[model samples]
Target: MGSRLRIVLGQLNLLVGDVPGNAAKIISNALRARDELKAHVVVFPELALTGYPPEDLLLRPDLTVRVELALGEMLREISGIDVIVGYPKRQYGKLFNAASLLRDGKVAATYFKHRLPNYGVFDEKRYFVEGTNPCVIDLQGVPTGITLCEDVWEQGPVEQAQNAGAKLMINLNASPFHKNKGKERFDVVARRARANGVPIVYLNLVGGQDELVFDGDSFVVDGRGEMTQRTPAFVEGLYLVEVDADGQVTPITGPIMPELSEEESVYTALVLGVRDYIGKNGFAGAVIGLSGGIDSALTLCLAVDAIGASRVEAVMMPSQYTAAMSLEDARFQATTLGVKYSFIPIDPMFESFLGALKEEFKGMEPDTTEENIQARIRGTLLMAISNKTRKMVLTTGNKSEMSVGYATLYGDMAGGFAAIKDVPKTLVYRLAEYRNKIKPVIPRRVFERPPSAELAPDQQDTDSLPPYSVLDPILERYVELDQSTDDIIAAGFDEAIVRRVLRMVERNEYKRRQAAPGVRITPRAFGRDRRYPITSGYGAETKNEPGGNGPAGGI
Candidate 1:
């Protein structure tokens, strides 16, 4: 048993469904760590072969075969250094999220993920069958305990490894990012390390896969539950961590990297999420309707930053109610950012729509119909540009608007990606400010102005909804915190406003379901994060029955 051992927690980024590409990444990183760093072994994240949560791609026979072949290739290529990698292993008509220990051009051992998180953003139960064994093997004569992502989180597998005389635990993960997710990981790893009386290497996959963004904050903790090294979030690279038999980890000295701030980390996560989504799907560019509002301005900035300014186009679709300052601000911001800007008035289109519906609405009062008509007209024009230019339309609705149905369906909600759909209005303003801090990209006037849709004359958002300062917190409590109407009201919110907001949220379930994929910064986003039935009688109306609505309320 050598006291000197090198382990590389290969926190690498993997593209979903790219079996060959992902396999190449795994082998490349392993070789780099083994040859260049002179590490004894390199470990990859959970399901690194087919990419984490291959979603429905696992159902394809050809894709599964491709993944299996790639896995075999990885196993056959590497020899000198042992490789601990995660991949899908098929056995007896069941798919297991398993990790393989490869040495001397063959798989030495394998371990399956035990805990399949079926709640919130996870759907592992729908895809994988759980495995019930602790994968403990010898690495350079040191006992190494292998556990897949979710397996390390629970007690049974890690405890079983300790009971089986394992000394070090290596957990491969493809964990997704959610605001303070890194902190959660640190806490969990610390607890596990302390309880197991052994060091743990927590490695994760980084990159954007659909709405989910995995932040590779791969870290190491000693037996005393002390963090030794950490890789930065929202980026990809080989993080080399050396562990001793005494259960201590120390960073292999090279380029000393500065860690990102919480705000910067989250901000970069959103940018990368959007960048990968656009780039991976092969969109020519992104088209966003810039209304000189905070949400649209922030979205435009992110779009330009994600892909170059040349790749982004900002269109101003002003209706009759649009203010002159708004149009100017929109133009100013777009030009300042070097993004292509275009203005298309919607009054003519509005008139045509009104004429078509004139007889039907002959005696009815003009209300949200006019507002929605303006939205639909803008949506149509954006879609037209998108269809012609092969650019993806970018929706700018934030979580605040999305939570209460403030956005118009098939109108402002029309896009291939909702860049800021998970961000709340208050955070939207903060992000706008954050963007401006680097360089004043968004016009100060845009932030100073009162928020409005400008769908109808003098239509301010505050006219129909509570102030975002008030609304966002309440929405966060109710939506993210899953607070009841009574709970929201107990938090000092007006009962009537809480009820109204909850009602709006419930009624708009259909719209949210149809909305495009968006970056999820919050714990619960509109996409896969929050799953609710569209055609449901279940509202705040059902009570304390776990997954049932307790009362009738709106948000």
Candidate 2:
């Protein structure tokens, strides 16, 4: 038996449904792990061959064929090094999330995922049937068990593997990012390792997929439930671990990457999400409507960081009510970030729109309709620029406004992607501060001034909504925590304000449904994570009932 056994954890960023491309990457990484690292085995993240959560793409009839071809290609090309990779396997007319162990250019063992996660952004149960068996393989006299993502989250798989006489466990994952999610993962893995008395290697996928951003904080934990080795978050690399002939794993003596602060982690997630979405979809660049507000400032900073200053464009569309300070700050930000800047005053467009709508508004008094026209004009200009330049328009609405329907649907909400849609307004200011610490991009006055849509004369956001500091906590409880109106009131909030906020959130379902997808930094975000019906008759009218209000009110 060999006295030393080395393994490489390949934390890679894979594109969904790109079987050929993903296969080529896997083959290259496998060869590097074997020849370069001089390791015995290389382990890839969950569904590394097909990317993650391929969603409905797994149901395609040709998917099985493509995956098999890719697997066969890897098997034929890779030799000497054993490789463990994740993919979807179809057997007896049913699909399963399975991992393949290859040795000497042939499959040595296959392990199917036992637990199918169905809650929170996951719909695995919809596509895959549960796998009920344990797979243990022998490599250099060490008995190793294999498990996929959610399998280690439960007690059955690890216990089953331990009972099957496995001494070491390797768990593959494609876990998505949310606040403090890394700590949650570590807690679960440590408990499982100590409970089963087995050393565990936890490997995770990295990169962005639509609204999901996977932070590759992979690590190895010993039987004593201590983290021995850890890779940094939001990075892609090959990490190494060693074990002896007696099946004892060595503790990593090198530096364990420090955990990122809440603000830093969220900012990084937004950057990665923007980078991957634009890069993966083949956009020329990103165009942002740079209002001299905190939200747009933060969005601009994120875009510059994601794709560099060369690929980002900032447009300032001033209106009749536009303040000089706003214009100055917007230009300062543009100059500071080194992005292309353009100024197109919308006064003429606003006059033209009013000229066309004069007859239609003969007997009507002007209100939000006039303000909406300004926003819509800006939206139209941005979209036209996007169409001409093939650049994606990154919207700047934050979660606080998005929740209470403070956003205009066909106006300010018109864009290809929303960079901060899932970020709350309060967090937006923090992220701005975070970015400025790296370098001063956003002007200081932007944070000091009150937020506004600037559609009407002296218009401030407080005119229609509560202060963000007060509003954001209420929103976190109501939207993300799913607290009831009464529950929130019971928690020391004004009942009238709570009811009003809840009503607005309930009535604005249609708007949010039509909004662009953005990065998810919280536990619950709109789109895939939270599903609400657009047309519903629910209101926040309740008398101390638990499930009183319908979907909107309950949310």
Candidate 3:
């Protein structure tokens, strides 16, 4: 009873709705931990059985059948180690988020998650009911409490466990990534550990699930709120943690992994998100439409990093309007990255299109109608290549462009995945700089050049939209924060510009609804995270209510 406890933390990246595959991995990890690591108990993330956010898959009756089949296999195979894992449990004519202790070939103790999160990418309340009691299990001599993701955010579950005389707490999570979420999570867990005088072992699932990427910064904290071990973010592995229990309190100790910087973390999230989305969906490779601008250039780097330069292809479909510098820069990066590069001129095809439409449109000045034709031509070509090679088309549009009505729907936005859809224009430049720091792949002129779609003669993005420096903040306030028009104006933004930006965002709901899925690096992304009606006549708020200056950072 005076011996130390050795627990293996399984920070895994699991696919959604693959119940049998996930359970197999769980059993395999448990056996490995017992044999190689010599650990007594191995813990997994929340909903680890069927993967997190199973969504509507939870409604299928056959899902319960598959789960029971997986359970039967685990009971037959799992032994010599205690596997504390999470799964969706069906009981009493209801479903609850539940976890159980599989020790010595039996379910020793089970715990149900008391809190169900229902905001911003989580609809747990729709799928699961609230758990009332705490399930405390004895690992050797230590009484450990089990809680799911949202339970740690609130105080009640951990407090109830503490009242039940839990010496250690294990909180399983499928918490997704957003900007600076690592710090927010650590602060929350550390505070709870200190306040309740209970050591906490926090394990989170790591991988991209559609728009959400869970950065696995799993760690263990002492009763005094001091972290003893921490795993690196955006990685999948089995890490070991040791705790010495003296019946007074549990002291955690192990090797700690370093946390990533802001730019580093966001960039890594982009790479992981792209990789998993492609690999999980069974795409062969990634095909990016490379422009000489920073957005495409940065996206190219991400693709090469994500899959590899050999697997990535760069296509530069230049038009008469595309600048000479753009052509040079795009070609240079493609050669430098050593990817398959092609320069397919659109002049001949574009001319044919104009000739075909000549009778349909007479004496019409070359307007955006003509500009859009060029984009559509490029989109057509890229999609054609994607169809032939099975390489998914990766779009180059950023959040700011997508936020407003700046992006062409069937044109530039035509791709399988948008790596930086949640990233703003300002952040795009920063990521370009971040990538170049490792090795200067993107040309200097690419960053310095004025951003344009290159679909028209002598064009610039600023001609149609505000400067990203100012535009990004306004979009963040209006789109992500839901700040009223008056509130944004009060916080040092021009009223007219604010109103115009609001209108653009509101009018473009239909476009965003059809946009491709991308990584969510911000608190609120376009799809799944932020849902707004496309046909709503609900006007943008212009309330005069006093809400002072919004905090001046998120860029």
Order of candidates by TM-score, top first?
2, 3, 1
**Tens digits of per-residue lDDT for model 3, 299-397:** 999999999998899999888888999999999999999999988999999999999999888977777778878888888999999999999999999
Per-residue CA lDDT of model 1 for 1-555, tens digit only, reads 427668877877788888999899888888899889898988888888888779888777787789778977887877788898888888888988888888887777988888999888888988889988787898776787888777767788889988887888889898999888888888998999998788888888999988988989888887877778888777788767765554343322323345666677778888988999999898999999999889889999899889999989999988778899999899999999998999888888889889999999999998777777788888888999999998899999988888877777888988899888898999888888888999998888888889998877787889878899988988888889888888888878887777777777777787788788899889988878788888777764632333233211111
lDDT tens readout by residue for model 2, 1-555: 548778899999999999999999999998999888998999999999899979999989899999999999999999999999999999988999999899987898999899999999999999999999899988777889999999999989999988998889999999999999999999999999999878889999999999999999998888888988889999998888887655464444434789899999999999999999999999999999999999999999999999999999999999989999999999999998999999999999999999999999999998888888888989999999999999999999999988988888878899988989999999999999999999988888999999988988899988878899889999999999999888999999888778778877877788899899999989999998889888765663532345233332112
Give the TM-score of each candidate: 0.94, 0.96, 0.96
* Pairwise lDDT winner, candidates 1 and 2: 2
RMSD of candidates 1 onward, in order = 3.7, 3.1, 4.2
TM-score, structure 3 vs. true: 0.96
For all candidates, what are the clash counts?
A: 17, 0, 0
lDDT score for candidate 1 against the true structure? 0.83
What residue pairs clash in candidate 2, if any at all? none
